[model samples]
Target: MSLDLAWRLLKGGGRKGLLSTWLTLGAVAVSTALLLFAVAVNFAFTARGERGAWRNPVPAASGAVAVEAARFDYVGDKEITVVDLAALKGDAPAPPGLPRFPAPGEVWLSPALAELAGELPADQLAGRYPDPKGVLGDEALVHPGELVAVVGHKADSPVMTAARSQDWIVGKGPVEVASLAGTPSEDSEAYRALTLVASVLMVVPLLVFGGAAARLTVARRDQRLAALRLIGATPGQVVRMTVAEAVIVALAGALLGAAVYAAAAPLLAGIAIGGGPWFVSDVLPGPLVLAVVLVAVPLLVGLSAVAGLRRVVVSPLGVAKRETPPAMRFVRVLALLAALAVFPLLSRGSSVGIVAVALGLAFLCVNLAGPWVVGLIGRVTAGTARKPARLLAGRRLVDDPRAAWRTVSGVALTGFVAGFLGLLSPSAFGDGQESAQLRIAAPVEQAEAVAGQARDRLREAGVTATVRVSKEERGQNRLVAVALGSHAGTPTVDRARTALAGLVPGHTPTTQADDQRFGLQLLADVRVGTIVVLSVSFLVAVASSGITAMSSILDRRQTYGLLRLAGTPLEVLDRARRAETLIPLSVMGGGAILTGVFCALPFMAGGVSTAGLVTLVTCVVAGFAGVIGAGALSRPLLRSVTADPAPRPD
Candidate 1:
């Protein structure tokens, strides 16, 4: 009986109620889709990590099946992962992505590398390896376009024991491996941590938006539910009816959202991170995660809907008389303060898990304090009002701060995200060494001999350069340097690198950019990630502000109508509406930004960079513009509601 009544009411709310229902559904859809996309990033990184782990072989103490060594090689600017392997026993299992262990003089390249090799000249790239005997399988590569080569060599090859100048640069020397199973690389782990952090930044805002969906059209729903109570509907009946209505709409929305994400997964695979774009499979949160989202979103929405009924359930008479609820407590602000205080203390050198928890708590605390700050702003606005619109706006704020907060909360939280990432975004490192220098590491005893070879190679290649052997603190060996002339550039660098490729046995010749390539790539990725995070945050902010603004008008249509009938000008009502959002948004948005900056301070080793300052200012300007634009878009709705002053059954 309750379910039947719920259905009737849901279908009978006329056009405005129907519009509210569709708006709520759309909000849920947006929230669910964004949530899935955010979660997919962590999973994608994990997949990439696992796929590439076999390259970092774990040594076996005894009964070893194969000997393996891996190093990074470059063609132009592209990085190629080269793995050399030799079999100790006939039954040695092939490393991942091969039909069988390669025979001596045989080389296998990934599909991408094979294609690349065909396009480049033999001396530049393909000549570095034996002619390709086969293409590597997907299991041997991290992403679809990864460059990898597996070359079979004699066990006694000099490459096996060549000195690895740096573990990160030259890769580890050959080790006897029993199995291909290995752990994720340090770079992979770092990326995973970063993706997780990005998820939290995105997901928290998505959740807050989702919860706000349940409260859409609260005033009208509360009135109808309260009247039912006043006419003898049991509390259980009311609760059941509310749950049925909210959960059903939410479930439909959740399913639609999951479909949207699934459809967009192929497109999302193109977002480059950690060296390359993703495989389609990597970007999908699997069926288990999909099931969880479909179930959990509706449950959350239902609970939030029920929680908003305290007034309707506890005091129907008061709701009927349209009395204001008590102001939110100051404790909410303290909660935010406490969260901000704890973050810096826990941030430095703490594990990723700890930092994540602190950030999550801080993110949620921003949401918690937003309404209380809005209430305070309302009180101040009302006390200082000097005009009709100001008085109306102030009265609205004091009357229902939570509603006003909902309209601006997305922007406030985005401000927090912007400030946090903006402060940590990296700037370009100093430009050092004007001349291009190519270098290779050699044993201290062999340094002079390698230096002699380097000079000869550069001369034969017609490259203008000076050669020297120098010792750096980072390595135990001496480095043979080929310092090129002022006019030397990419083609000269490549020729020089190829000429000296085998000069040092294990270590490849490296340019200054190659020496610092990993660090530079990491910095570049951070900047890209910052842009992505901020872009998504702004989108959510705009959607929430716009949708909630329109919903607020729908929720308060009767009030706007009454005001119009009482001779309030349309211009005054519109000004009041804008002031209601603008006042609290300024206060809460600024506060959230400060809180975010405070949280990020512990990581600011050299203080804020110029790029960071620019990001902050840009976010502030964009955020204000987005919110104000959302308000402007809803002005027509405001005008429409006031155009008809008479009340309807809905």
Candidate 2:
């Protein structure tokens, strides 16, 4: 409990201890920083979304109305059904005297829709703005020359006339229509998806740092703890002391992390929203309160105490001598089994599959096979090495495979998560179908003519198109079709639609088809980002593992020194250690890859193909190689341990 004694003990572990502590701190720092950013962004966006909803709620009749339109081609296919505003109003319909339909050639525009189209150029606009005729192509429902009125729904003001002019062409319709309602208050699907991604990313580094800290606390301090026991210190006292040290370190790291997050919150918010705080209110203090309670405090306290507390309760004498309790092994076994069982459930087609695989692999590699793998690899490599330095490296690895593997595991897990998440970039999904807009003419005969012309034009452009027709209540119409082609730029479906519209003398086509160019661009960006993040994360993991392993090697200096005196060259010793680590790394790496891919198979099967499988395999191989290379590089650390003639008692 003496400050002087604790400081001296802390300083005595030499370079190994110093390096290990720094590594732990660095890992903790990086993990906490990234986690903070992710959490902050998530909260900021969520808050903005919520406020945007409150400021612009959907009108009572907003959900009921829909626009019905035909396909772009002469085949007269049905495309989309715009929301039905009439049904939504029900008993509270617009003044009873109000016309049920807009006067022929005239239409109503919602304030939200008006704002969206306000900036569009008149020449570029294809048809009347905001009218059901423009949106649903219902020519009969609209009267010619009737005044177009812009009505505000769910806004502070009832009606604010927009400065933008309407583009009401006599024959064709607008290419797309804006929704009468504002963005939805809640997108549960998107929230759940982001949460899954964020949780996986956050937990990876937490486990790495926590495990490393725990191992270091128990491993590096064993000799000192053993010496204290010899001086009549009780096991409980030693354990308590170790726990106290961990508490101090965890607390310091956590508090520093939280402070860093708070100071950078503004910057973080900007990144999340893509500009200045968009939905934030200066008058409201609730977000600030929520940030602290929901994000900062819990992260610090939970990460700081979880690992260290467990390590502290163990008997120092036993721990120092490397006599970890049998229960720990049992726990490891149970964890491995649990991970194995959960792997299939995760891989079979859920977003949570990635997290399950990451966690499962961490448990198996770091907690279960670490020591055994390190020792086995070290021993085998030592047998083959001719160089004295290399042999010593092997022996160092073999002498304490567990510590070596622990280092490898930490780095490997970090890399795996980074790579996996990087590869599945959100952009890779492309703007889903939700964002695309499709529009067509109203009259069945006109729609059919437009569809045929579109088909002919697309065929000339070397695209194949199929169109289906359908009718709605009281003469509403639509067209649906899938187009195929090998054009390099825009999707063939979109190109065909455009060409078809041009062929119709007086009609224009409006539809949301795949934008091949945009899709490709998004894919490319995601691929690049994934590669970069994965590579950097992997390298960091590798370096941390090697350093930690070398530190472990140094801790067993006396043991290695005795082995040397017993005619074991430093080369053989180091080789043994390398062999021990290699086996587990390979096993765990393979297992992780298989498990991850297996878990992702169900979801990926629908979209990703054999190519994605290859990509994943490549990632795993690169990750494994990086870890092994790091272990190999730690040989120099072993050379520093002097070979002494005296033998030490086991």
Candidate 3:
């Protein structure tokens, strides 16, 4: 009976309720799309990393063609990775318009590499590759960041046999596809773990937003449910009715989200992972993952609704009269301190995976206690409010602190993530060069002149350093120089770099600690990953901010009308609404950021980079600004609600 009544009520919801339902649906859909896309991208990256592992021993349809795959740092600096042409082929047959196999020493470069190297073949006159006329052709590649060239070799050649094979089998393979899933390398494991944590942080708030959307007009719902209580409906019956409504809405929203994800798959497939754009076929989750998401979202939504509606279930009179909720205590602030203590311990000896998991746990604790902290902040704000608008907003928050917090908690949490990510990515290679060894690579003919110019530049820029020609690799000559105290940026390194760029054909002077380009690329990758998640979180925050604020205004129509009747100008009420949104936003966001910085402190012992800190603050500010804009957009609703005073029943 309760379920039937719930469905009837839902179908009869007026236009406003219908609109809220759609907003809820969109929030859930967006969240679902993000989660599935994250999973798909992870799978794609892992598959590409394990590219050769599967095709190494494949079944033969009679006999299958096999090709070798070898990856090398094209320029010794790891600026880009180059694979032999056969590497991209996997177990596939020879591609049309290309040689079935190249004679020994022939190679193909990716367009990006060819562009960087001025279309030169693998061998002649470039920094590396060691041979000229060895370059065969160029091809566009996809799926990873910088796999830039492919050297080809004849089938069954001695060199080819020694190399690993990665051709996706065109014919049947001896090994089962299912058996080829290998454990990822430690690096990949750590990366995926971090990515998963970011995804969790992003999705959690969306889930919260969707729940809020479903229960939009909570005050109205509470009033109605209380009347149901007054009329002798059992508490269990009322609870079931509310849960049923939330579950049905959530289930519908989750399905809509799955559709949203499917529609967004093509866009996601284009994201670069290993060395190229992911194959579209690799960008969808398996059935198991889909099933879990679909089943779990509704159950989670239902439970949250039950928890939120407890006030109505317990006492009809209390809810109907708009009783104030219990004030939150200061203990909620301890979660941040606890997290601060854990981070230092984590920095000392924990693995990246463990650290990420612990960080996630700490975030959860903060989120759970966020409302309490927000409530305590309300008391502070009320005590401090001097302006009429500020005082009224503070009083509203004091009346229902959880409701106030929900308006901006999404923004607050994003700030928290931003802070955590700020110091989280230092040189993956570690800090302090210990020795500022500048590695110089130039043509054999220009080696001495380049070394001389490098030394002269260094001398001109600052204090002392020594320069020496290092060694020859292939056709290029090399030199190494050691400089004093430059793990921190130095003008000498900058000047030397300028001199080298003028001398070397492709000016890339590297450092000993900088080693290969891997560290820089890895840092870029980490930032990109964080940005992707943060962007989505920001969008969720803004959308929920507007929708929930509008819902709250509609639910509080009578209260606002009474305030107007009591001679509060609409302008003052409007300012109060803005204050209500911005106060918790600024306070909680600031706390969240502080908590994030505390979490990041141990690893950034030398202190956070000025650039990093500035970037994070800018991002957090931009996010809050967006939320504030959303709140502003909902002002018309407030005007409409408070336009006329409605008499209350005695």
Candidate 4:
């Protein structure tokens, strides 16, 4: 019997039931898939790192030798003493066989060292070699100075060429030697942090899509559940039947979504790296996990539906009558009080101020004022609506005021979060002004010359700039820092820096921008796009719920007619409908906004501000008014009650 009844309900609901269920399933599927994809990427990266595939290759001898210096001076008159190969190995090669110490008064160079020497003239290169005794332990190579010649793994040799050098050395013995011990790859803390952030981002799309579907399903079917009760079905049976139907729909949608994600996984991976092609073996494990999420998401959504069924069951009578209590009054009051108390803290630059203001405004607009606003608009607009459709809408709002607010809450919350966070994060905007120390790459010998040239160029361009040269702690590379005028735009700064970087003799220059600007821009884009999506979703839900509610009301027109004949005025009947809408709208709007605010508080406490608060509130209120106005104008459908003279005997 239950199966038969469930089937009947599914068939009756048809497209509407199927759409709502699939939408919910899609939400879950998308969210879970993303989570899975992230996991897979992490796994792939870990596996790659374990293999030591991404490391620099060096000769085996270098790994065994450790050169140390006392009180190492990077820029001062300190020197590196290289250990003798024979001493380190405890074995000496025959005199005539291996050329020891680069044929006396000479030095052996690594591929990197050879490349640096090649950059200078042959005459200049002679002086560039470090004192042979200072580096090697034996002064014999330096004392004789027998035409000091440096022997290195050949520069043009296939395996020993420098990374930055274009030329290669030919005719080489033992072109490259493998290091005796491989260095372990270092773990990236940043990558781990990004993975966590990506995982968190996955939740947003899930909640957004799933919550939207759930709310729409409940709103649209309230009247249907009420009718079921009137026809001798228990509320429990009605709730169970609805849940069963939702589960079926969700499962089908989830399966479909999974299939889509699996097929598209490769494409998504390719896009991740600037749309470059990637091999199947290189594909991250994340997409595969997303495929699994497809099924799991549907099941979870089904569970969520079951959780919400109680609300539909206990209120069938109220559903038919369009009655329910306003939502979150106490919570809203608390939010407002918290907002007031925290206002002072904000003035003191306490980060908590952002949270207090965001919560207070969200509560005031979404919860407290939402229903009343809907009701007022419905009443005022009902009289002005000339079209039958418009009049019918107005009348519906007048009958059930709370329902209007429920429809607008989802979109409002999405907008609020986006706007609030986007404005404060500097990286979100691409301004990149947060780093304390700057590094510029250039040749050691030409470091000062490059700085001077950069200063001259900037001055010629009517921009003041400061330049400083410093050596790296390891004495590996010379660095230059250029401080441009405060008024320089990012593009200007970038251009100037790029031009100046070219003047540096043998070093590549790279710039790091502030992270805050990137974050802010990302948030802003999300806010605008999500709001549009929310708006469309809300409109669909409202239209579906409103039509369903109106149909039920029309079915009971005779009841309304009899009440009118029994001396109830049209105004009172209108108030009753308005009150019905008021209840649901208030509950949904208040709950949604309060929940949104509560969720956003932690982010605000972290640094998001309240400048966008008024805008968010205004948008929410406007949306509510528009929805209510449409409902109020729907009143002409109720004209049938006044048109008929006699009441039907029930």
Best by TM-score: 1
Candidate-wise lDDT, in order = 0.85, 0.45, 0.63, 0.44
Question: Against the hidden true structure, what lDDT does model 2 obtain?
Answer: 0.45
Candidate 3 structure, TM-score to reference: 0.74
Would you estimate the TM-scores of all the predictions? Answer: 0.97, 0.59, 0.74, 0.46
> What is the Cα-based lDDT of residue 437 in candidate 4?
29
lDDT of 2 by residue, 1-650 (tens): 64445556656756656765555555455445545544444555455444323112243333433221111121112121112121223233231113443332344542323333354432222122334333221121111111223221321111111111121221112111122223422332354344545445545555455446445534446666666776787655665556555545554555566666566555433322111222223212245653553344334434443344333345544555555333223455455556556545554345555654555464344346445545655767678877765566566566555565566665445444543453353334443332223344434555566556655665776656564443531223344333342332234334444455434322334433322323443454445434534554554566556656666665676767777777886667766566555555666566544544443443343455444545566667777677678777768767766444465452
Q: After superposing candidate 1 on the true structure, give the runs of residues whose Cα lies further than 4 Å from its correct spot.
A: 428-435, 459-464
Judged by lDDT relative to the true structure, which candidate is superior, 1 or 2? 1
Which stretch of 10 consecutive residues in model 1 shows the poorest summed lDDT? Answer: 426-435
lDDT of 1 by residue, 1-650 (tens): 88888889989988888989988998899899998888878888998899888888888988888888888877677788888888888888877899999877799999999998888766567767647999998888898899998988777777776657775777865888887776788889999988888889999999999999999989989989989999998888989999999998899899898889889989888888788888899989999988998898999999999999888889987887788888788898899888888875764587888778888989888898888888878889999999999889988998999999999999899999988889897655634332378778888888898888888877887767899987663477877778887687666777777778778766777777776677777877898888888888888888899999999999899999988888999999999999999999898889889888888888776678888889889999999999999999999989888878997664
Candidate 1 — which pairs collide?
Answer: none
| Model 2 TM-score relative to the real fold | 0.59
Q: Tally clashing residue pairs in candidate 1.
A: 0
With candidate 1 superimposed using the best TM-score fit, by how many Å does residue 485's alpha carbon deviate from the native?
1.9
Span of ten consecutive residues with least summed lDDT in model 2: 156-165
Ranking by TM-score: 1, 3, 2, 4
Candidate 2 stretches greater than 4 Å from native: 1-8, 11-20, 51-188, 255-335, 342-401, 411-475, 479-540, 560-583, 607-611, 621-625, 628-650
The predicted structure with the larger lDDT, 2 or 4, is 2
TM accuracy, model 1: 0.97
Error of 2 at 465 (Å): 18
